[model samples]
Target: MTQTPSSSGREGGRSLKTRVKTARKRSLSSTLWLARQLNDPYVARAKREGLRSRAAYKLIEIDERWHFLKPGQRVVDLGAAPGGWSQVAARAVGAEAGRGRVLGIDLLEMEPLPGVEFKVMDFLEAEAPRQLMEWLGGKADVVLSDMAANATGHKKTDHLRIIGLVELAADFACEVLAEGGSFLAKVIQGGTEHELLARLKREFAVVRHVKPQASRADSAELYVLATGFRGAPGA
Candidate 1:
């Protein structure tokens, strides 16, 4: 689903802390999450700016510095839900203006956006790459993944799961991205594993970890950006 750009970031205001009272049915963790959502500046900003989620700012900050998403480029957003990144990508690539295209895929259903084509398909499916390419109508200029596995509350397990997802996303990107394309995915603080990092370095001219200010300082989440993709063999 393509999303139209919302109002510019010019409108802004400070937010007051909001405390959530724990109900008899609400767990402490849920209560804390609610409170955090209520107090988060990015959350308020997203609401004010008519954006999908606070995660949108993370992409905005990263792209502002890196300048990867460009006009008339096709972009694919893996695991896009609530379409925050898709929204940003559509605007950056001018999809809404008909200059570019944006395709988003996820297992969960997403509400339609103005400049996005969305599909409900699990990225883990074996035919996913083929299907996504068919939907996109060609190779992608950029592939983005903000997917995360459900937290198991075990640091090691969580880290491994996220790395696994990133590895899969990287593999998909390699299959679908055009020459000189780019791939961006979320990873934990430990960063990509040696094998994956080495492969990415070989496939793309530049590979680095990027932390956007919009991301929570206390969160371990980090984005791995790989740019200048070398063409796939026999492509």
Candidate 2:
């Protein structure tokens, strides 16, 4: 059985946090990460509730506040590996009943999910737009990108990489979103995305950054939401 983290597990009538014993082969970072996961409420909740990942809660919380995902909304989930956000999208959009469409694209192979179409492809490739359009069958009502580049350990480089990925996602959203659509993407907190923000403002009626509670307090990650797309020409 999977270990469940709870206050009920106690020693001497006092609750204690779960700790991972460091193995000879385990790095300190690996040990700490395991310990954190073992203690995280979202991790336990995801397992209990049958969500694919804890990351699903981040998208759920954001949409709850923003009211983006809805019935009959065609959704595109870029970098949708592990199928967490796609699961939420399917349920929200009623895709299983054919009320809307949900398509997920990622370079990584993902197990199939009901009501969501999965494709293994790199979103940066030239054919990506065409393929996603074919799956969507028309302009999307919502575009979601939880994609992040691998961390390089250097703060500046990592931030720049995520920003670049977000920029690409935003550009793709602009190309394929219907008027009044919404775009949501992950971006790190920093000064780098000012130009991206300016461009989004020109194309979207509102652009804002939201940090979901599911995100660790120490993480610099934030989601950028752009709503009411203006449908730029040539896009």
Candidate 3:
């Protein structure tokens, strides 16, 4: 089991270690979840690497393979809870050098990060894209979305929910991406909607679907990487 450096109990008003100890003495589910977290190699690696969440490595691995991120680029991160992907993006785009910027948004509140600007709001609302555009200050070089709808356990329904999120993210990307910009978003294994894929094919020079190694084998999630954007109709 791996343990990271932890701040004092007073920091968050109560210690997670104490809560975990109490939960271990009571609930089976809590114990199992904690055990999994402790044993997860990515979790341990993230702690050692100073990453906010294990999910950061997934994006890093994907970008390593695809070579999408570039220095001096502007990026938009959707569903950026816990600031993991934002951290990775900030580093890749050279935020420290003042040549890059990242704007992130999510429905859940995120802890502060050095280079990320995050907002808490439901992205499905109409005004969300407007706000993202305003923050971006112009078109973005890349739009990345790791958004997933809360699962309802019905396989078909859950698939639709995730696809909906992907579609919305794609639509917003089309609106704000500069020519030759890229869009990366999560989708299910069953594949994307035909209409959506058709649209992407028409708009992007290359549209490839990939499943990163860091994504769990049993999970249905995959990512769609679309590059070389063509301006949308009437844009």
Q: Is candidate 1 or candidate 2 better by TM-score?
A: 2
Native-to-model Cα distance after best TM-score fit, residue 211 in candidate 2, in Å: 0.8
Candidate of highest TM-score = 2
Task: Put down candidate 1 lDDT per residue, 7-31, tens digits, no spaces.
Answer: 3334456444677999999999999
What is the Cα-based lDDT of residue 216 in candidate 2?
85
Off by over 4 Å in 2: 1-13
Candidate achieving the largest lDDT? 1
**Candidate 3 wrong stretches, greater than 4 Å:** 1-31
Better of 1 and 2 by lDDT: 1
What is the model-wide C-alpha lDDT for candidate 1? 0.89
List runs of model 1 lying over 4 Å from the truth. Answer: 1-15
Tens digit of lDDT per residue, candidate 3, span 1-235? Answer: 1232232324557534423453536687767678667656677678978899887877887798888999989998988988889999999999756789988888788988877788887667887767777887878899999888898989999988888888889988988898899999888876546677888899899998888766766677888899999976787
List all candidate RMSDs to the true structure. 4.3, 3.5, 7.1
Give the TM-score of each candidate. Answer: 0.92, 0.93, 0.84
Mind sharing the TM-score for model 2?
A: 0.93
Residue pair clashes in candidate 2? none
